[model samples]
Target: MISGALGAAIVATLAILYGRALFTPPSEIDGEPLVAGAARVLYVIDGDTLQIEQQQPTGVVRRRVRLIGIDTPELGRTDAPLKAATADQPFAREAAELLRQLTAEREVRLELDRRRRDRYGRSLAYLYVDKRLVQEELLRRGLAVVDAFPGDSASMAKRLEIAEQDARKHQRGQWQKQ
Candidate 1:
């Protein structure tokens, strides 16, 4: 009986240790430093996110990146006019398609500001393609709305505000009249 009790204690201790290791926070790991500069887009996840590949000590690392300062409407969100009217095709689908056409397998530059990976482990980056900012493109095309997060750099914030103004004035993409 004593041996069984001892074994159970050992098992409990081991379980606790293993659980702690498995759920270790990012702050605990010596996370890869925030990388900036140029990279190539391997794929586009949506209007505001893409997967980019960059060189690292362990060969090339691919990062799933979410664009800062933009939030596109959901594919079937009731707030989306296009989705409300069309039962067949949703605006989110169209935006994703557009992003794929623009960024898939293309070279882009990335700029990192405050945080690196979001809670979900996706890298948060400001992307540029063909000398134009990707966030601006989404806004200009009316695919996404400007939604700046805290800790954004001054210049980037200004640029995003300008892009949003442009989109609003022109009523591009989803901003267009119904």
Candidate 2:
């Protein structure tokens, strides 16, 4: 009985440790800054997020970044016809492509939100390309909808609300008639 209990505890401990390592962000990477200028867009994860490649002293580091205050419909989400039509491709791919068109290879500034990285270890940042808020631009273009997770509790909800309202009013993207 004692051996069984000890073995169970050891297994549980290993599982937890592995999970933490998988989910937690790295303490430091070559190009990551607590706060820094926006680098070039390497790729977009979704309409509301992207991966940026920045040059650091050591080398280039690709950082996954989520746009503040926006969420777009999943590629195959129930309500989005376009997304559903392209079921073979992941939902985020379209958004990423659009983002690439908008900001790939362009220099932009980056601002940190309340949190630096999300549970998935992606950076949470507000991007500004040529003085434009990348998040707001995505909203204006109807590429993404507003989304605020629990980690963004400190953010100003009003911005996301307004973005959603505008997208609805304009019938942008999935909001438009199929």
Candidate 3:
């Protein structure tokens, strides 16, 4: 059996490591913040994904950005037969529509986390529009659930969790009883 002292020390070490990895602020390079630039949202692909035209020092670049700390229902997939669901997932359209209304053609700031890209090569970020956090809004409306990854922002995850709880308590959007 593991000793109590050793287990406590191990847990403490793990917590410290996790906190550093997930809560570290965005880095600065040459006295400028790395993700300080703003991007115009070309389109919202879904509730949590967007295509953006970002203005960089070199030129304008278009990229797909996946929102951090939240997940909405998936839209229908006709292209992939493996996950073959012809119909959209529950509340998918509502989520997508709300996202579109929130960000379409608007300038949004992308705040990046430690893991900058997902496996699919989409930029991972916390999207903000006019200083409003889109993820928190979605969670508050019950349109999304907290789906933070290990390297995503810990503070953001906490905020999202609270929003989701409030949504559930009031039975808003997808949380409404059928």
| Highest TM-score against the true fold, candidate | 3
- In terms of lDDT, model 2 sits at 0.68
Q: Mind giving the per-residue lDDT tens digits that candidate 2 earns over 1-178? A: 4698899999999999888767644433332563577488766656766777766675566677877667765544355666544452333555656777778778978877677776677777888889877777667666677777666644455666677678779887556666
CA RMSD of all predictions:
7.1, 7.5, 14.0
Please provide, for model 3 over 1-178, each residue's C-alpha lDDT reduced to its tens digit, 9 standing for 90 to 100: 8899999999999999878767642221122223545889888898899877776675556677888888999888788767755888888899999989988777888888898777886777898989889999999999999998886678888989999999999999899999
Q: Estimate each model's TM-score.
A: 0.70, 0.63, 0.76
- lDDT per residue, candidate 1, 1-178, as tens digits? 4698899999999999889878754323435554787788877766677777786664566667888878776554355666554332345776788778777677878888887767787788888777888788887877888787777787788887888788889988877888
Instruction: Go through the candidates in order and give each one's C-alpha lDDT.
Output: 0.75, 0.68, 0.82
TM-score of 2: 0.63
Comparing 1 and 2 on lDDT, the stronger one: 1
Runs off by more than 4 Å, candidate 2: 1-34, 56-60, 75-94, 149-156
Question: lDDT ranking from best to worst?
Answer: 3, 1, 2
Worst 10 residues of 2 by lDDT: 25-34
Sorted on TM-score, best first, the list reads 3, 1, 2
